[model samples]
Target: MKKKTFWIPIIVFIVTTSVLYLCGHLFNIESLKWFNFEETSNGGFTFGGSLNPIIFGFVIGFIAEWIYKSRNKNRTA
Candidate 1:
């Protein structure tokens, strides 16, 4: 697999998570949380939570790669 292709999901995930976090902070949405699994309370963001964004990014990337390869195989067959 190409290295660039492998990184697409990671980049996308980071961008997505960051945007969500910023939006939550800007809007002061207590329930809006990004990366961390824990929900916001009292209109404040938590420093630590159950979900890890990096791990989630990697998992999403792997799934994307798998699906792309599967489709390629079918197309070639």
Candidate 2:
């Protein structure tokens, strides 16, 4: 796979996580509040609270990768 193609998934994951984190911290809006019911703080990171972003990152990464691969295949065909 091309380096640019590989980075697409990573970029998508980072952007998704960042957007979720910023929305949670700055706007006090928890898009994934359903997953986080308890409060647990460790150092500068919270488990339940922070896990949402990571989960979202994975989800977004998968979706982005799938889409990217699909488009590439179509273009090549």
Candidate 3:
């Protein structure tokens, strides 16, 4: 795959993560809690979560992009 094709997945990941964080902090929506798992310890804050859909989506996007590039490569050759 060309180097540029690899960026699509990365961009998706960043956008998804940012949206999750924004919704969690800015909107104060409890239903969106699954987006980020937050906690406090020793008077400090911690943040984390499974983000399963993001991971799954990225994996699928990467694979799809890979297959597309391969097919295009063969078509042009």
Candidate 4:
């Protein structure tokens, strides 16, 4: 990813995941699962439903950014 587009993949994943989740509900499909995949079967209310993806997305984005940035940094140096 370029500097200007560094966040693109992660954002796309999050947005796509959200859209799929919504569509899953609309279409009565149970196959769609969050990338984080921590859904509880008890039908209880939990912030994990939303928080998991953000944390997962952030951690993934940070790791990818770190790796690509370091690769470029070392190459430039």
Winner by TM-score? 2
The TM-score of candidate 4 is: 0.43
lDDT of 2 by residue, 1-77 (tens): 68867899999998888777777767666664423454447535343555878887999899898999899899999
lDDT of 1 by residue, 1-77 (tens): 57756676667677755665666567765444443444477776656432444455557667776777788789889
Per-residue accuracy of model 3 over 1-77 as CA lDDT, tens digit each: 45667776676666765676567557776544454555677677666554654665567667767776888899999
Sort every candidate by TM-score, greatest first. 2, 1, 4, 3
lDDT (0 to 1) per candidate:
0.61, 0.76, 0.64, 0.58
Candidate 4 per-residue C-alpha lDDT over 1-77 given as tens digits, one digit per residue, 9 for 90 to 100? 37434675576557755766676557645454342244468965443233444455566666666776777789899
Least accurate stretch of 10 residues (summed lDDT) in model 1? 30-39
Q: What would the TM-scores of all predictions be? A: 0.46, 0.70, 0.43, 0.43
Q: Report how far off residue 72 is in candidate 1 (Å).
A: 0.8
State the displacement of the C-alpha of residue 35, model 1, in Å, after optimal TM-score superposition: 11
lDDT of 4: 0.58
| The candidate that achieves the highest lDDT relative to the unseen native structure | 2
The alpha-carbon lDDT assigned to residue 55 of candidate 2 equals 89
Candidate 3 residues lying further than 4 Å off, grouped into runs, are 30-77
Off by over 4 Å in 4: 8-48
